[model samples]
Target: MSNTASLKKEYAERIVPALKSQFHYSSSMQVPVLKKIVINQGMGIAVADKKLIEIAINEITAITGQKAVATISRKDISNFKLRKKMPIGVMVTLRHEKMYEFLERLVRVALPRIRDFKGIESRFDGRGSYTLGIQEQIIFPEINIDSIT
Candidate 1:
């Protein structure tokens, strides 16, 4: 087998069983289905600010109680080719029991709250991943105050 395949198989065998045990899933067959919810796309001036990223992560964690990883990619439209690096967006990966819980909350509760919101348009990124974009973060019901004391 190829090196990557071998590594993946080894990792899955070790990680899956452990995750099942840690999350008290009872059986490996009960592992929750993971869904990737992409939060933005850079067409115009998408809010790629640090504050926004923090707010998003905080809101997601608060609602889902799942830690999310946020990242920013700055637009680098130099050459005629629009192949510049842009602040893509944040990706929240929910795992184990949290995965199902988050999905339910996302579809039923969180999505409706987003203002001027439209359904996600999914497209793959060549690799085994999908991408989608949100126009604004107004959908989340999080208070964005200057100070949190």
Candidate 2:
């Protein structure tokens, strides 16, 4: 979409220069750049109902504009009655153009619609990446309210 194009252009035209001046970066690579955006939805109930996992995958695919991959357990935990290779959640990794498009939609359209919005809690990771959790996927326009299962 055009949003992705403008985002990339803005980075090159505006953001890069600002970073170069502020940090006095000798090289463009050190200024840092966004690599990917990962959208995840965890469905613990899927352990009880396999149908729920399929439904989750469909919903995540609709939200991210990409096929969703089911996240399986790495090892069995007897306390939780969880087993290895059992579908527990669904997720999609958006990269390049898709990442920009999703981010633009999230900031511009979806987030504001959340009822009683009180800003977000963001935590940065080891590198420059950060993780943000959205409790409701219904905030995005892509998901149909009636179609929710």
Give candidate 1's whole-model lDDT: 0.53
Stretch of 10 with least lDDT, candidate 1: 39-48
User: How many angstroms is residue 148 displaced in model 1 relative to the true structure, after the best TM-score fit?
Assistant: 14
Could you give candidate 1's per-residue lDDT for residues 45-70 as a string of tens digits?
A: 33434365565556556655667665
TM-score of every model?
A: 0.40, 0.91
Model 2, 1-149: lDDT tens per residue? 48889988999999998999899998888888888888888888888999998988888888788999999999999888899999999989999988998988988899999999887777677877787878888999988999886
lDDT scores of the candidates, listed in order: 0.53, 0.88
Residue 84 in candidate 1 has what lDDT? Answer: 43
**Model 2 spans > 4 angstroms off:** none
- Model 2 residue 104 distance off true place after TM-score fit, in angstroms: 1.0
Evaluated with TM-score, which candidate comes out highest? 2
For each predicted model, how many residue pairs clash, with residues at least 3 apart or on different chains?
Answer: 4, 0
C-alpha RMSD for every candidate: 12.0, 1.6
lDDT, candidate 2, at 47: 89
